[model samples]
Target: MVSGQLFNHKLLDVVFENANYGTIIIDNNGKIQYISNKYCEFLEVDREDLIGGYIVDFIENTRLHLVVQTGKSEMGDLQFLRGSFVITNRIPIFDDKEIIGAIGTIIFRDLDDWKKMNSHIKDLLARNNLYTPEVDQANGARYSLHDLIGNSHEMNELKERVKRVAGGDISVLIRGESGTGKEIIAQSIHQLSTRSTKPFVSVNCGSIPEHLIESELFGYEEGAFTGAKKGGKVGKFRSADGGTIFLDEIGDMPLHMQVKLLRVLQEREYEPVGSLQPKKVNVRVIAATNRPLEKMIENREFREDLYYRINAIQLVSPPLRERTEDIPLLIQHFFEKAKARIGKRVNSIHNDVYELFKKYSWPGNIRELENVMDAGVHLSNEEFLDIDALPEYIKRDSENIRRDSEKIQKKTLKELVEETEKEEIERTLKNCKFDKNKAAEALGISNSTIYEKIKKYGITE
Candidate 1:
């Protein structure tokens, strides 16, 4: 028995359908362009009679037109028909920035049968789910807030901030030092937003060459340039329509491209390199950078107007040092990931290794920490990540810090105070050319007291 019944028999023009599963395709106008012969057999209807009919007229409870209009997928939706629940998936077909049509598939004829999935079907679905060719092309969000791995105050605040701003389509500027996981924050925001199913196109503005960025972003026609592709291609902007585009290292974007980007943000439209007509897009812009945009603006290296436009809502990711409490959590997370990836039996991290990790200042932040874990896991000859497995810098820095800390701990409070005072007085005297009066004034002390301290500390300069 067919799930859809012909409601409109009037003829309309149509074209397109995929038949691997009981599939159907409809044009933007909801007119059925193609119906698989298998489905026609299932419906016991003549293919000629259904081809030009409106999908709603031919299919029971169809939402194909809804996807065509919204350009968003409706996957695994339950449709109760003929005393049983059926599962359906409707996906919009996009041509550049516009939705051309929608395709549908009858995933499950009945809900009960779907629950006890056959092994072959389950494997096929699993492989497709891993990365449907469409998904790879979509640049879907890979990480969500749940994968953000942190429990510190700073991390909690950052998570809350991301949650608050993710509901809107406004521009978001993520400011942080390099390797502070700015892109992770960007992905989390996209995944949490209304456009989660849509593409999450990430472009590292700094990585692309200066000469190619414009065409890389706005695209170009086939004959626009000597080295252009045969058919021409949609730019990242067009590919990101109805979704989010994460512009990483945004400060490195050239001034000319910034101008075009500013216009696109203002007008929500852009012209491809050789196209006469401009195409409109509905995309959320999430820009991130480690550079000081204000400084860049002051130096005239960045556009002030564009800065304000993208910085309407700003988020600053705290450096790893600022969230030290989360270091152990991140360590464990990376360690486990490395274990699985490397297929190693490294069972534990030594207490000394943890101490060194906690003591060292992570200049490269979380990225550096992850690298160290990977190296240690690979180098470990035993079941633990010990000092022998760590990089040389880790041990050297840890030892130096330990020695300095021991020396400081051995000093009495009064001796430490005097040592600090002596260093300050000597530096001041040298800067003042050894003039007692000048040194005293600079040190905020009386001349006589300065002289006494200098003498007491045995300063002879």
Candidate 2:
């Protein structure tokens, strides 16, 4: 720590070039006074070359220069460079209210480094919260639009909607029944977006405990609360910095957290626990829920303001039952996925399985089908998946569906109408002491016609 004028490049050349952390010192005008070796590596450039360049020339979206101008400090802030969020701090050096230079420190180079740091933090936080954070910080988007898989009209339209929404930088809310692949749609949107190169963090709002929800989403400072770690932990919003965050089962999020989430959505900034300053964030949110948010709002369980903020664009995942035409496609896809994943010789599926799948209502949607296929493949020693390989509950459902189908198939519309007519005529006759004229008037038909219908239906006195 020298207090002298050592901002010259050649003076600190050897020292800064070999620094372990990604550190940068910029003058009040945002000119690079010095850039450390680690930062040069993250920037994919030579330290000597970047020593005297402008900060904006290298970083896509940085606010360090602004920090120097405003003399305001920003710590634990996220900045996007290349294809990842680099957690950084920008502290302005001031001499009696006069700004001199700003020091910027970065956390990680890429997703791998971020994962290493995040995993450590999760380990520390898990013991206290009894929950582990999502590993979405390791990468962006696991599935693509192609993974949506279906040629039905509902699927076609939904896919098109995804493509359209992906091009924009706005909040998206995905609505669907449980197991209908809402998270898949969310991932698809992130995969197709411009931020696909960054992280895709997922959080199950309902799965998280109510008490820990605040710290989990917004992070906390050192000793912020009773169980707060030494250095505090970065939340999902920070990990997702410049990428996307998926909030699944959002309706289950507590009302207090909903207010905090609404603040982030509205302000694009969040104050971590025990910290007075609000760290700036630039993340796209894609929330999913099977529950009716509007109804929840009516019940005063959800915030109406937050609803509008997240509902900038909405997509409805088509229930599997509604698009039965895609059942065959989904079956083959999940079948191949399961077979490949299991690394087995389960190469074929019986025709009866396909028929049963097509006939079933699929109350649990695509996820249930995938799970069944996975279980079936796992249980199969034979080459083909047969009725015997299916679960007993599925077999029962299939049988009931087939029986209902047969019952409908056995009777024609005319036969059913005549049978109903015969029963009503007999009822009216019984009510009127079997008088033909009175029965005809009560039946709303001619006496001859009623007699003919009764004979046709095999009804006799």
Candidate 3:
């Protein structure tokens, strides 16, 4: 019976000794008062070596001191030891609302524990093959749907259409001007779709040389060409398997490549260059072009069959000039980003500078706007971006518009343009602003167009 009692006592002691947590106690004077056996083992020291020693003498980082000083609980995941990592929490031990000392618990975490978390993510993207964080991070250059930045009715409808189209696996053809975020819209569609977790591979069809275009889309086998990779190389289509492959400037793809691409679209399969075995990939092709494909088809530069296949879903991103209302938001977002990046504190954008922006036709669209702002931020020494700091295009355009607005005011030219529009719109709204049928008749435009511009231009009584 006495032996049984002793055994139970020893087992209880062992249970306490081998507990998973390492506990440490420190005094207000930054000296360690007590450390549990687990901590002594963790620090690779004896009880005598740690007790009554300054905490800093053991732990090299001073963040712990700051936590004790502020009497706040601090927690973090860190590599607390060589080849060992831990998640630690340090809490202040208070006596009657006064922080007397601190007690900390360090819980070692195995690296393999997080592997399970990303395992599920990996399973989802296995078919497409995984892209590294470096690829995703490299592409995240403030280019997304957020850059659209408009609350107009037309914009809202367009967004709704995009949302509906993105949910499916249909091929999308986005049409817009050079800088008008057609590629951005394509990316948005990819991000919003079920394939968002997979690779969003992009290829500028126009930029590839004629000789290399075939090998680029359908990667070459080893010794297929003099400079091919040692093993077999994966094509963009295969790389974007089970995901989205954005073909930017698709109108520029050569006729021969277009015919080859059309076959892949028709059959949903492709063979790598110099490889006999065909690789079948389930990729949603999102093609974008500024060129009019129908006109190109007439010119025989683009294939009609390819056009029909890619145009299953169509989106047109209006130029920035058409959506001038969003210019303010775009300006603010870009300025804030620029300020944070360049370490500046600009108070505000100048009224004249804004006027210049509004007057200038952004031929390059949103990209040009950003470039202009970037230049303005770089050159400005004052709180606001002044007119003199603006590019010559903006300055010249604004001056011409101001001169024209002044010269044409209250004249026949104004009557034929501004007055004509305002008078027609006002007359339409006069007969019950809520009456869509009457408004369409009075305005001599479609009911949809009136409704769109009404919300667009903020035309409210």
Candidate 4:
């Protein structure tokens, strides 16, 4: 038994040292106990220097000690190491309800591996854009007006307004809740405009670091900073010269950057980082944000002049809840798309599915609906999508609605009939959670009729 245990320990040691990725193990006290040879090599340090030392002594910006203290795992966190980024997983070790130590694993062997992985991910996204309606063939915009699917009056009016302004070169401000297709509207306007042939550059102001936003938007000169690209880097504005630059989450832009953006809009020119000469560019701006800009302005978080500049032609993308009439159409579109992508044989969705969908306030709007449909298609094993395939949160929401509805008292015969009808529909939906068509068949009614009844009774799930 001792020999076997010794062999197992030896095997573990070999595995840790020879693993392609770097590994580090530290005790609960935050003292480094073990450092794999790979990790030592990656850090350019001798194991003897680190093994008995506190982790902070050698590693910069490390949270492994915090993980040990909090007894929580931090997974797939990107950290700057050496001169490049590395994806790491720091997991706390537990022993019989007590915190023991922690293990930190570097996902990439080197910076080259991280770069290769990033490139592959970008390629996959580009390929996906080809399949979805999110991209325009002629303009290279991520989405066009045709991708904006809806039949509600609000949607129709929004579409008409977009078409009217598509011919003009005025700055547009798109306002809406999160996931309300702000970016899609921006892309559509870009695609339909006269600058359709030119590049439609997009930048998320919130995503770029504060210090880097100016250089990223207006380009930079050679030696603009320590690591500025050689021969300078072309900013999004220059890249979209004579085209459109869609600035997403504009509300999150820093006040200083907002001032610079305002200047670009006013003069149609911008100075690159480390350059005194202002470069001219005929770039149309379409900014979108979920933030309440008026409130931001009141709070002094966003600039007032910049707000007015971008708000010259404002378009509001209505949230899914406000346009519940479009739920069925959006569902059908998403379902068909998801089915084709997943190679699912499913051809029909149950009316109860739509019933539940309509009843639920879609906080994430169309994006959330698409995600739910995609998930449903992948989860479904039958020929149709039903309540069983819906996400757990959706199901729980429906249950809450049903429970709340049960409290309503029926005083009249008409009310009693309505209550009975609602109860029956709810029960049927529950039993036939895997097949909405089967539920409709059991009720001796057409699928469309069931949908009408669900809408009338406000039956969910």
The model with the greatest TM-score is: 1
Q: Model 4 over residues 1-461: C-alpha lDDT tens digits?
A: 01234224346568886676788888788888778777877787887888769998888889999998898899998665652346789998787777777889887555345444433332234345633324345445766666788889999999878877776678899999999999888887766555665788889999999988998899899998999889999999998887899999999999988889988999999999999899998999999999999999999999998899999999999999999999999999999999888887886898899999999999889999999999999888767899999899999999998886775542577877887888888899889993668889998999998888888887766
Candidate 3's residue-wise lDDT over 1-461, tens digit each?
Answer: 01234224245346545655666767777787667776666566897787778988886553555566899888763422421234577888676787777877666322233222223232234224442223344333223444456776656677666666765678999988898778767776665555665778899998889999988898989988788889968888888887789999999999989988997888998888989888788888999999989999999989999999999989988888888877887888777878788887778888877767776789898889888888778777757878877778777888889898887774886456755676667666877555866888766789898888677556777
Instruction: Report RMSD (Å) for each prediction in the order shown.
Output: 13.1, 15.4, 14.6, 22.8
Report the lDDT tens digits of candidate 2 across residue range 58-85.
Answer: 7789899999888889999756565434
The lDDT leader among the candidates is 4
Candidate 3 clashes between residue pairs 3 or more apart in a chain or in different chains: none
The better-scoring model by TM-score among 1 and 2 is 1
Between candidates 2 and 4, the one scoring higher on lDDT is: 4
Sequence-dependent TM-score of model 1: 0.66
Q: What lDDT, from 0 to 1, does candidate 1 have?
A: 0.80
lDDT of 1 by residue, 278-327 (tens): 99999999999999899999999999999999999999998888888888
What lDDT would each prediction earn against the true structure?
0.80, 0.81, 0.72, 0.82
TM-score of each: 0.66, 0.62, 0.60, 0.60
Candidate 1, backbone clash total: 1
